[model samples]
Target: MSVETVGIIGIAALFALMAFRTPVAFAMLLVGFFGTWILGGFRSSGAVLITETYGAVSNYSLVVVPMFILLGNIASAAGFSRSLYDAAYAWVGGFRGGLASASVIGCAAFSAVSGSSVATAVTIGKVALPEMKRLGYSASLSTGSIAAGGTLGFLIPPSTGFALYAVLTEESIGRLFMAGILPGILMMGLFMAAISIVTWLDPKAGPHGDHVRFLQKLKLLGKAAPLLAVMVLSIGGIYVGAFTPVEASGIGAALVILIALAMRALTLSAFYEALLDTVKTTAMLFTIVIGANVLNPFLAMTHIPETLGTALTTLGLGPYGSLAVIILAYVALGMFLDGLSMLVVTIPIVFPIIKAAGFDPIWFGVVAVIVIEMGMITPPVGLNVFVVKGVAEDVPMSAIFRGVMPFLMAMIIGLLLIIAFPQIALLIPNSMFG
Candidate 1:
């Protein structure tokens, strides 16, 4: 059979396996292994899978993933997220829909450390939902804000999304992290605006929270200062050339642990749990990486990426038009696939077309992540919405989905802004790394 035909069959088999609820990693591994064996020999496919697994696991740069994840897990166990919510609440909680806005800010602050959207939603939801409920906020608005804010975990600096994209595309982790900074802030602002509009349309949806004295606000801010400091040091250190992304992760992890210990919030048992969770999460990430690596070679043998890129170029669609199609595909796939799986599965095929079109990979990484974040809130398979629902059990799942709609629109607008002005993503990375 022709190589293209083999590639098409392989892709079909892949989707079929996924349809049956096969783990994405194992599905890719099985398809990639057998496909490579068919195109090459068993010997070459065996070598490829073994080598890819080893390479993915032993890569030095990847240490950043677990280290950053550990920092987030430790921070969560130690109550740092609550302090962040408190600080945001002290400042913004008194306005109409202020509690929900504070939840967005709090989510952003925690995401700066957590780097996982699900974790961000769950952590902030546990803290923010009750307060919003007490303040008479609507379930839709309250749950909606937390779910939407959680997406920041994937867009903000130290994002796992950026880190994994860097691994797949050979982009600089530091530059990708920098690229996300401005866009993350812009997204957060847009979410806040969504809350403002939601509350304005129905004041009953979000009532005023408690007013705090200036001294009280400062005190709450002081309580959360350690988290802010850790964020600045880890992410800022990269921009200023003080540390590599990996080093920054290590430092951030150590700093958060020490802060937790100093506050008497981290027990020996909690530390152990943090380590365990980090290992589990890290192992999951590595499995996906290795699967992608194995599958990438099989794909190369089939020449699918090259053929697809050539086909797209022949279509005479300009760069922006081509980009629109890709983004639309992601939105469709996101209805069923998790962000990480969607990313790993598609990058092998998509990255080549993007590069051929002369688009910047780093900027594309930011754009890709924002779209993935949108998927996390999109319905039928809205991962973040499900996560928030789990935490706010009293709030119906439908309400959470309804609440996330405005934020989803805001995300689309932010994405368009970034598309029209790539510099929003490129400015910091170009200035710092040049």
Candidate 2:
């Protein structure tokens, strides 16, 4: 069989396994091992796998993954999420559809600390869902907002997605983080706008409440100051070259723990749980990453990406046409795969095509992350939707999915905005790192 044919078969088998509910890491590993064995002799394939595994795990840049995850886990357990929610609620809860708006704002703030989308969803969902329900907000609006808003976790700094993308594509993590800020802010604004339009069209979707005094709001903001400061210092420190990503994570983690201790929110039990969760999450991410290391090289050996790039170039589609097709492919895949798995599986193939198309790697990373974020809230296997469902069990799954539709539309608009004006993502990175 041709190398291209083998590559196609390998991809088909991977998807079949995934459809059968095989773990993504294992699915990739299995396909990679067998595919490499077919392409090269088993002895050679085995040696290559071992070498790739070691290289992936031992790389210094990959260290940022665990450190960032640890920082997020610590912040999650340290009551930082609660403070963030309270601050947003106090400021916005009096406006029409204010509770839903608060959830979006709160999720953005929480994103500053927690880089995992599902973690952000569950943390904010648990804290905000019940209150929104009690205030008579529709289930769709409440659950949908949290699910969609949770995607910001990766769009902001300290993003695990950004970290992983940096390691994979050899981009600067600091610049990638900085590049995300404007796009992230724009996305948050889009969500807020969606909430406003929804509530305005149908007032019952969100009801206003008694306003908090200015002093009261000020007090609530004070509660969130520690989190705000940590975010600014960690993100700012990285941008200004004051610290590396790993060092910034360490500082952020330490500050979060101190804040927890100061608030009396950290007990021995909570601390232990934070450590345990971090270990678990980190182990899972690394497992998939290592598997991708083996699979990516195997895929490369097939010459599929190069072949596709050549074909596209011949077809006269140029860069933008090829990019549109790639984005569409992501949207279709997003329906089935989680964002991380989708990225790990496809980026090795798609990224070279993107680079060959004359796109900047860092700029592509931001756009790719946004596409993955859309998948997180999209249906069938939307991780964020399931997370909100876990929190608001009484609400129908369909309603939650329905609620996220507008935000999903907003995300689509956001993606177009980023694509149309690459500078929206590139400006910060260029200014800061140039």
TM-scores for all predictions: 0.99, 0.98
- Global Cα lDDT for candidate 1: 0.93
Question: Candidate 2: what lDDT?
Answer: 0.89
Candidate 2 lDDT by residue in tens digits, 1-434: 89999999999999999999998988988999899999987986898789988987887877767777777777778777888889999999999999888999998988887788988888988999989988999999999999999999978887889888987778888899899899999999999999999999999999995589999999999988988999999998988889988889888888888888888877898889888988899889888888888898789889999998998899999899999989999999999999999988889989999999999999999989999999998889899998888899899999999999999999999999999999999998899878
- Candidate 1: the clashing residue pairs are none
Which runs in model 1 stand beyond 4 Å of their true positions? Answer: none
Look at candidate 1 and tell me the lDDT of residue 397: 89
Clashes of 2: 0
Could you give the C-alpha RMSD of every candidate to the true structure, in order shown?
Answer: 0.8, 1.1
Give the alpha carbon lDDT tens digit for every residue of 78-131 in model 1. Answer: 999999999999999999999999999999999999999999999999999998
Off by over 4 Å in 2: none
Candidate 1 — number of clashing residue pairs? 0
